[model samples]
Target: MIKCNNVQEQAQDLCGEIFERWRELLQSGEFILGDQVLAFESWMSDRCGGAHAVALNSGTDALFLALRALDIGPGDEVITCANTFVATVGAIVAVGARPILADVGDDELLSVETIAPLVTDRTKAVIPVYLRGRPLDIDPIIDLCRSRGVAVIEDCAQAIGTMIDGRQVGTRADASAFSMHPLKTLGGLGDGGMLVTRDPGIAEYARIARNHGLENRNESIRFGINSRLDSLQAAALNIKAQYLDQWLKRRVEIAAFYDDVLSTTRTGTDLGRGKPGNAYYHYVVQSTHRDELQAYLAENDVQAAIHYPVPIHWQKAWLSSQPRIALPTTERLSRQMITLPCHHHLSDGDVEKVVTLIKQFERAVRW
Candidate 1:
């Protein structure tokens, strides 16, 4: 069966170089905040068009640090999209802020129009996630936040290399957090994350926050947490960083192929699909017959999944006893979305096979 992503195959292709670097790092014993970590941070900062980048243990840490740098805590509310991964909301709540979810656009990214209504006097920040590697419209969001004196923290977990109009995603917000989980566009072999900021003070504060609130190695000036990136993971990430552009290109090529085939197959019907603007982390398309198509694909030897089957507010953990406000767009998206394979490692033949299987399923169900 064709899997959604094939990280093992990609790792195998570079194992020799990866292992050589890993062995060297193990022997060095300079683990935390070492040369490997510094080099990776510099490389990532340059790539993301930021003056400073702080490497952390995970993407969730990156978000938490960014919030801490901005001094966001209890009594503050952070506006974010209801359509994003729960981690986005989790980070805000973990930092003692209330996550005020707003509706996302049909494209599955945060919409500035929906955000305005959610902001209140207690709202301290807005996190617009680049969901599925698609860039959200950042300029307006930035402008809106700036006008209101609120911080903008971009959740760029899936959009490591995505660019809008001309600028990169991380460069657009006050600060951006990127996840290097195995499934991300610029994923490392193990977990890793980075925080990018143009503000020097914010960068400095985040650096201290990632460690234990130490103003310096010998000084503990404030409360902080231990969230440093492992040197071994940095070594693996440095090697992977060298090939990120090529991987991004291949993903774009595969997405184009899917678009060509799926569009033709949908001819007169409304599949509710749009041409993706960047890397296809997940080639999600909307349909009323989502369940039928999913089961059909499974029978035809193609593995498919959903980006999110439940909106944040509907999750039992997040629900309250009070009657919930209706979020029509978020509800529709949860039921209609289905993601197909669109990874860098997929061959042209793989793309063709996936498309063929999907078309067969659509026809069999008369969708």
Candidate 2:
């Protein structure tokens, strides 16, 4: 079966070089906060066009640290889209803050307009997620937050290389948290994440916060956690980072192929076009018969999945005594979205086969 992502295959291609560097790191015995970590941080900062980048253990920790660095905690509420990975909301709750769920736009990604209604006196931050490699229209959100003194922490887990009007996602937000998980556009061998910020002070504080909030070797400045990206993971990530642009190009090509092929099929009249700034992380499409389409793809040897089927507000863990606020757009997307295969490993032939299979499935179910 064709997997949604092939991180192991990509890593295997670079494992030799990565292993050699890993050996050097192991021999040096400077494991945590070493030269490799520093180099990766600098590389990521330059790539994201941020003043500073702090490497962390996971994307969840990156979000948590970003929140902590900004002093957003407890009685504060963070405005974020309901239709996102639980990690986005989990980070907010983990940091002792309330997650204010907002609806997504027509493109099925977070937007400033949908977020405006969620903002209030208790709202301290906004995390506009770049879901499925599609860069959310964040400029307006950033501007709105700036005018209201609310911090913006972009959830750029799937949009590592995604650009908005030539500027990267992390460059626009007050801080952005990126996941280098195996499924992301820039996947690492293991769990890894980075926080990017234009403010040196925030970056410095996050750096400290990632390592148990210690100002120095033995001095504890504040409460923090052990969230350092392992040296081995960094080495693997650096190796993969070298070929990220090429991989991203391949994904774009595959997504284009899907668009061309799926457009002609009698699947659904409305396939829902991606926004101009999207990078097609998962190449999602909207179909009224989403469940049926997914089942049909499975029968035809095509693996398809849903980015998120349940909105955050509906989750049992996040439920509160507060009255349920209706989010029509998010609720609608939760039922209509299906993600198709769009990974770097897919060849032109693979794209054609997947698209053809989807078309075949659509034809079988056109009732």
Candidate 3:
């Protein structure tokens, strides 16, 4: 099957390096959080343009802790894209803040224009996501938030290698959250995440907050949670981080191939093309017949999935409390986006086969 992701195959290919790291970690006997975790954090910091890094248990925690570090809580409003993973809004609600959903532009990304009008006195922060690893010009967003005194926490969960004007995306915001979930370009064997910030105070707060808010072994500084990155996961992540650049390069090549071939299809709309900075976490296409197309691909052994079928605001958990807000573009696109296979594991032939299958589906729909 042409799966949306090939984590097992990718891990199998790196079994030697993974086993070696695992062996060293097991022998060290310092497994919880140690040199390995610290090393990974340092590496991430450097990758994010020298930002102070605090490794966490999951991407969700990274987002939650970023809010904690910023003192954003109850009664405060946090603005984020409506069409995002639940974790984005979950982080805000987790921190006792109200989540304000903003509509995305045609590129399916948040912009200063969509966000500026949402800012108010209660606005504590704005979380702009690099959805599908497509980087937007964030300088304007940063400038807008700065002038308004609202913190900007970039949700870089799907965008580790994503760049803008030669600098990585995580470094541009006040604090950014990243996930090392196995499907990510720089994923570890298991779940892990990192929070990057340019501020030392926020860095110190996150460091303590992740470890039960203890400044020392005996003294507690604040009420915090246990969200430390595991040494085993860190060890594997350290090994995987080495080949990230090449993996990203391969993903872009596959996305470019998809763009070139799929662009001609009349029923489907190809997005994120011709952008050098896009990490192509998921090569997405919008079609009026998205469900039918996905089913057709599945029949042909070509796996395609939806990144998110329901916008966060429309979720049952939030539907009761969230006022009926109009996010036309977000609501409209939720039913149309389909995530195709675009990973480093696929070869040229694999990509061509998938493209051929999609073309076949498109042609059949035309009739």
Candidate 4:
């Protein structure tokens, strides 16, 4: 079967380099919060337009830390998109803040217009999730938040290389949290994340906070968590980081091919016509027969999946309060979005084969 992502295949190319880094790490023997971690942090900061990047154990922790660093806690409302991964809202809840929901635009980004209505005196921050590797049009949201004295934390888990007007998405917010999960475009060996911020205060606080809020080895400056990005993961990530641009290029090429084909067939809708430099992490398409299309693709050995099938407020966790908010677009799109294979490992032939199978399905429907 043609799988959605072949991380193993991609990792094969970097095996030697990673091993070398690992060996060097072992020789240096700085395992916990070592030089490698600092190196990776520096690399990411430089790459993401000079933002101060603090490496952490997971993107979830990064989000929690970013919120915590900002002193956003109970009674504070953090606004985010209704159609985002649970982590976006979960992060808000993680920091003991109320999560206010907002609808999305046709591009599936948190509608800047929809968010303004959700803003109130309680709104402390706006966490705009950069879904499917497309940076949200964040300037308007930034303007709105600044006027209201609200912070912005960009959920950039799927948006490492994504650019908006030549600047990376992570650098566009007050703070941005990125997950380097095994499935993300910039996948690490295991769970890893980074928080980027232009604010030096936020950056310093995150750096101190991620290490259990310790100023020195024994001095506990504040309450924090142990969320360090390990030396080994840093080494592996540095190896992968070298080839990220090329990988993103291949992913873009594959997405364009699928977009061109799907446009003609009209079997699916690409709602992620995001900002110009989107990284196309999971080439998503919306369709009425999303479930059917997914099943048909699986049957044909073309692995297709959905980014998310359930809206946040509709999840079982929220069934108690049952948020009585109008999110018609988010509710409708949740059941209609399907993600296709847009990994770097797939070749031109693989892309063509997948498109051929999709077109075949559309043709079959006509008959």
lDDT scores in order: 0.82, 0.81, 0.89, 0.86
RMSD of each: 2.1, 1.9, 1.3, 1.5
Off by over 4 Å in 2: 266-274, 320-323
Would you list the rank order by lDDT, best first?
Answer: 3, 4, 1, 2
Per-residue lDDT of candidate 2, residues 1-367 (tens digit): 6767776787787889988998998899977878888888989988876468999988988898899889999999998888888999999988899888877777777777788877898899999888877776778888999888999998888888788887667777788899988778777788999988898888998888888889889998888889999888888788888888888788777777776767776543223374555667778877778899888778777788887888888887767634477789888878987888778777777777777777676667756
**lDDT of candidate 3?**
0.89
State residue 297's C-alpha deviation in candidate 3, in Å: 0.8
lDDT of 4 at 241: 91
Best by lDDT: 3
Error of 4 at 338 (Å): 0.7
lDDT tens readout by residue for model 3, 1-367: 9889988988999999999989988898988889999999999988887889999988999999999889999999999987888989999999999999999987889999999999999999999999999997689999999999999999999998889987889887789999999888888888999999999988898899999889888999898899999999999999889988988999888887887777788544356655779988888888888899899999999899898998887889788878877799998789888999988889898999988888888778854
Off by over 4 Å in 1: 267-277, 320-323
What is the TM-score of each predicted model, taking all chains together?
A: 0.95, 0.95, 0.97, 0.96
User: What is candidate 4's lDDT per residue for 221-325, written digit by digit as tens?
Assistant: 898889999889988998889889998999888878877778877665467763478898888887777787789899988898787888888888766644667
Error at 22, model 4, angstroms: 1.4
- Candidate 4 off by > 4 Å: 321-326
Pairs clashing within candidate 2: none
